[model samples]
Target chain A: MLLRLAWRNIWRNKRRSLIVIGSVIVGVIATILMDALQNGMIHQMLFNQINLNVSNVQVHKKGFKDKKDINNFISKPAKVETIIKNQPHVKFYSKRVITFGLLSSTDNSSGVYIYGINPSQEKSVSIISKSIVKGKYLDASDGREIVLSKALAKKLNVTIGDKVVGMANTPSGSIGSDVFRVVGIFKTASSEFDKTTVFIPIVSAQQMLNIPGKIHEFAIITDKYENADIVSKALQKKLGKKYEALSYNEILPLLVLQMDLYKQLLIIVNLIIALALIFGIINAMLMAVYERIREIGVLMAVGMKNSKIFSMILIEALIIGVLGTIFGIIFGYGINALLLSGGIDLRWFAESLSSFGVGAIIYPKISLENFIQIITIIPLVSVVGAMYPALKAIRLEPVSAIRYV
Target chain B: MEIIKCENLQKIYQDNGVPVHALKGINLTINKGEFTVIAGPSGSGKTTLLNLLGALDKPTEGTVYFNGEVLYKKKRRELSRLRLENFGFVFQAYNLIPVLTALENIEFSMMLLGIPEKERREKAITLMEELGIAELANKRPNEMSGGQQQRVAVVRAIVNDPDVVFADEPTANLDSKTGDNLLNLMQEMNEKKQITFIFSSHDKQVMERAKRLLILKDGLLEKDN
Candidate 1:
């Protein structure tokens, strides 16, 4: 009976009830879409870093990543390869010799981190082979061929078939120099990374630096990137404390921090929307209560308890909230589905977004957790909003209230 | 047998910081099965007396007893329960809930008492039939006429078989013919069910039908017959 009364009471002023309901619907949709957009952007950023450069995990000699000195090269490459092959999750691994060198063309010179890689093995670990924008990737037989980013090519005022010289410090404290042909130029999502990186055949680099049979880093790709941390832990334990196995999260701490900050921003935005909903609902319900002052008095005088009166008002508010939320979730998910398929095209801001390693198009994604959060929050907010009005209804003196117009 | 007893009933009101005494030093008792009327001019404390007697308000000074038990001494929750079980009220404006049908309004008090739905519906329909407003059962209060709405209010008041039925200016909004019919119905119910009926009114038609009359003037009891 109380439910019936409450349901009917809400319709007493249909326009007012709908206004409150409409505001609630808008709030739900805003929160859901905002959260989905933030998640989609962050997810793209993380995957781009992993696929383009970091692979899933990396193995480096102790102190090598900090200093990048020629003397800190991995001496026993065969032992590291044996342990990596034993890991079940390892799908592909590429060995590379890394050095900071100055590359000079006839017209310009720029400092770059040069990676000496086996062309076929590097393709299995990273997407650099597919990212070639100009000229062909380097071949295993081509000793003097080099592949550099478009940003680096532009800085050096060089193109394919241009002659360049690479110079770096050798392990013997002597300057090692080699002449190379620019074979390819590639572009990646991160412009900052593209501006300072180049690749050459491993044998050519080792011969130039006088470090035969030595490599600086092992880039490993797991079957799934999510399993990188588990595989890295296992490899670290087997390889002992001399070597460091680092996951993508460990290699790129800034990207992980960016994701966390976006999540906090999502929370703050939703809280602001929730507070607005609470106030809107309160104002609507308070008006409903005051308009029926005489009816409430009659209810009290006819032996309806104060508690029942309070419950009736609260139930009415909850009905409005639940009804609005139902429609909001339906529409929110519908919009999310449409955006997920077609994606939000942000190519207009590609220059700004690519600076941070995020892709141009984002596909909005929502989890079951998002659904649960919206379902619980709106109805709870409705109850809180109605509390003051319900209390006011029950506090009126019956005799004076009955006499009120 | 006495159903209600009151001693030195005094009610005062504060109108913007001025004390206006509405009822002063009135002693009264009403017996069961009596068709009684408390009559007075405007500002003569009839409504004030009814509110106090109905336990709807607290008197500034006085004690009201119902069936030899002190009415004001109980807690507010206890008073509400007592009213639900033993008292019925008919207001002047026919204060039926606008959203409910006539039958729903009639069964409201029983619904509050946790009565079964089927039982309350049957009781409400039977009472509406006796009052000749059974056809208005499915109609909301706004769909009914003034007299029909009043009949629904009366049926609602007495639906629980309350020990006392208090009517405050029940006929003020009705025409002469409708007011007489309402009075006749109340007299018939009073005699047939042996239910105590107390009314506060200045209508001559109401006073003529009453078996006992008490008149008030200037907040004092002027006469009793």
Candidate 2:
């Protein structure tokens, strides 16, 4: 009987209930899309950073990263390569000989970090081979051929087939100089990274620096990002004292910290939305309570306890919560599905987004966890909102309450 | 037999900090099978005396006893339960719950007592048949005529077969004919069931019909005959 009474009480003022439910639906949709959009952008930024440079994890000689000189080459590059290839969940890895050098053309000169890579193995870990915007990429068999970033090429006033000179310190404490033709100019999302780096065949770099059969770093891409830490730990133990392994998170701590801060800010945003909903619902419920003051007195006079009255009002609030939540979840799912399928395109502002290292197209992700979390949160808001009104209903004195207008 | 006793009962109203006594030391006793009325003009404390006797309000200077148990000393929850199990009420304005139908109003108190749905419905239907309102069972308060709503209110008051029924200006909203019919119905029920009935009214016809009448003047009991 209380359930029937509660259910009927909710619809007595149809327009007010509808307005509250509408606001709840709008809030749910807004939170869903906003969360997804933020996730999409941040996920893309992390992904780009990982693929462009970090991969999932990296293995480096003890001192190679701290000092980019050729003297800090890996102790046994072949042995480490064979061990990694045999490890479980290891998708692909590319060995690279790295050095910092000054590259000069007839017109200009700029400081550049040069990577000497095997053309075949590098493709599995990154899309560098596919980012070629001008001329052809270097072949493993070809020496004295280099790929320069478009921004770096422009800065040096060089193009495909233009001759450039590179100078770096060799392991023997002698200056190594080589003349090379810029075989390709690539454009990645990051203009800064593009302008500061160049790539050449591994053999050419080893020969130029007078260091044979040596490489500085091994970039490993795992089957999934979740496996990165596990593989890094395993590789660190397997590779022993010769090398150190680090996951993408360790390699990019600042980005990880920024993502964590963003998640906390989203929580604050959700709380603010809940507070707004509480304010909106409390007024409507209070009005319902006041309008039925005499009715409450009648109930009490007939032996209905204050606790029973409290339960009745709470049940009414619960009905509103159920109604609003049903609509809100459905609408949120519909919007999430649409966005997930046809990603929101920000191609018009691609240049600006690229500077932040995020992709132009974004597909918002709504996990089951987030959906459940949001649904759970909304009902609590309803209960909290209805408490004050329910208490007022219970506090009525039957004799005088009957006289209340 | 259940008995209600009121000794030197007084009720004071504080309006804008000025104390006005509504009941001034009334001594009264009511028995189980009596049909009683408290009659007076406006500001004569008829309603106030009824409210105090029914355990709906407290007295300022005296005590009310229900079957040797002090009414004023019981907690609010206890008093509410006492009313739920032992008393029923019919008000002047046909105050049926607007959301409920005639049958639901009849079943309201029984429902509060945790009566089973099948049994409560059966009891409600039997009472509706007795009152010639069986056909109006599903009709809401607004859809019914004033006489019909008042009849429904009377049915609701006695539905629980309570030991006492308090009717305050029960026929104020009804026409003379409907009021007479309702009074006859109450008289018949009081005789047949031997359940006590108490009323607070200024109507002359109602005062004449009462088996016992308590009249008040200027917040003091003037006569009990």
Candidate 3:
């Protein structure tokens, strides 16, 4: 009977009930959309940073990460490649020898990190072949050819089919210089990488550095990202401590930290909206109590207990909360689907997002946990918010209430 | 055979720093199966005395004994139980829950007593019929006439078969004709069911039909007839 009374009372003032439910729905929808956008942007950014920039796992010599000395190159590359190839989860692997060098042209000279990779194997591990915007990527038959970023090529006043001189320090403490033809101009979405990196053939790098069969790192790719840790750990245990295995997560700790901060900011915003919704609900319920003062008095005089009155008000709040949450979920997902299909182009903020390795276009994506949390939290907040008004209504005296308008 | 006995019942009120005595050392006794009317003009403490006897309010300096138990000394829950099980009230405004239909209003009391639905419905329907408002059972309070609403209020009060039915100006909102009819109906119920009816009213017609009348003036009983 009390539940029936509460159900009837909710519809008595349709506009007021809608206002309360509307506030809650707005909060829930905002929370869901914000969560989806943040998670999606983070996922896209991480995918680009890991798959295009860094491989799932990179094998480097122990103690070489802090100091990239020329002497730290793997002396036995064939044996290490044999073990890595035998791993069932390994989809693609390549050897890269990286070193800091100076590239000089007629007008300018700047420091650059030169990556020496096997052209055929590099395509299996990284997307560098697809990123070539001008000329062509280096091939096995193309001797002494290099690929320079568009920004770096422009700064050095060199283009495709131009000659550039690379100078670097060898393990013997001698300066080695080599002339290479720029065969390709690469344009990555990231400006920092485009300005600093130059790629050359692995055989050419080995001859210039005087390390005939040595490479600095083996970059491995796996089909599943979650398998990165497992493969890395298995390789570490099998190869002992001679080689260090690094996953993308360990290589990009700063990105992980930034994602955490973004998630925290989203949570704070969600809480503020939830608090506003709770206040709106409480206000509506207080008005409802005031308007039904006489009715409450009659119930009390007719022997309805104070607790029953309190529960009835709470029940009304619960109903409003549940209905609002359902509608909010639908609205939130609908808006998310619309925005996801028609991607949000942040071209105006392209520089800002690209600095963090994220694309200008963001797509919203929601997980099961986010949906479950929204479904549970809205109703709980409603019930908790109803406590004050319910207690106030219960404290009213029968005689005084009967006189209220 | 006294159902309600009050000894030295006192109630005081503070009116802008001056103490106004509402009930001053009053003593009264009423027997079972009686139609007792407490008659007084405005500010004569009739409602205050009725509130004490109905267990709705406590006396400031005295005790009220009902059915051999000290009503004032009981705990709040016990006082509520006493009101639910023994006392029924009809106020001047009718006090029918505006959201509920007349039938639901009568069943409200029975519901609080934890009466099952079938029994509560049967009793409420019979009481509404006895009050001659069965046809108005489905009508809300605002949809009904003043006399019809008051009759619904009467049905709600007596639905639980309470030991005593207390009404404070039960006919003040009705016309004289309806008021006379209501009073005669109460008198007939009192004679037929042998249930006690105690009311505080200024209506002369209500006082005339009472089997026993107590008139108050200046917070003291002026006459007992």
Which candidate gets the maximum lDDT versus the true structure?
1
The local distance difference test score of each candidate is: 0.89, 0.86, 0.84
lDDT for B187 (candidate 2): 90
Which residue runs does candidate 1 get wrong by more than 4 Å?
Answer: A62-97, A118-125, A138-143, A170-177, A202-226, A339-341, A367-370, B67-69, B116-119, B126-132
In candidate 1, which residue pairs clash? Answer: none
List the candidates ranked by DockQ, beginning with the highest: 2, 1, 3
Candidates, DockQ: 0.69, 0.76, 0.41
Docking class of 2: medium
Worst 10 residues of 1 chain B by lDDT: B74-83
Whichever of 2 and 3 has more lDDT, that candidate is 2
Off by over 4 Å in 3: A74-94, A118-125, A137-143, A167-178, A218-231, A367-373, B1-3, B15-18, B30-33, B74-78, B110-138, B176-195
TM-score, structure 1 vs. true: 0.90
- Per-residue lDDT, model 2, residue B223, is 91
Q: Write the per-residue lDDT of candidate 1 for residues B106-170, one digit (tens) a residue.
A: 88899999999999999999999988999999999999888888889988989889889999999
Task: State the lDDT at A139 in candidate 1.
Answer: 86
Pairs clashing in candidate 3? none
lDDT of 2 by residue, A1-405 (tens): 999988888888999888987887788778778888887788778888887777899999876556665788885788999989998889999988889889999999999888888898888887788889999887873489999998888899999889999888898889898999999989887666787888988888888887788888899999999999999999989988767888888888988888888787777777788888888779888988998998998888889888889888878877777677788878877877854658888889888888887667876766554566577877778878889998988887788877776
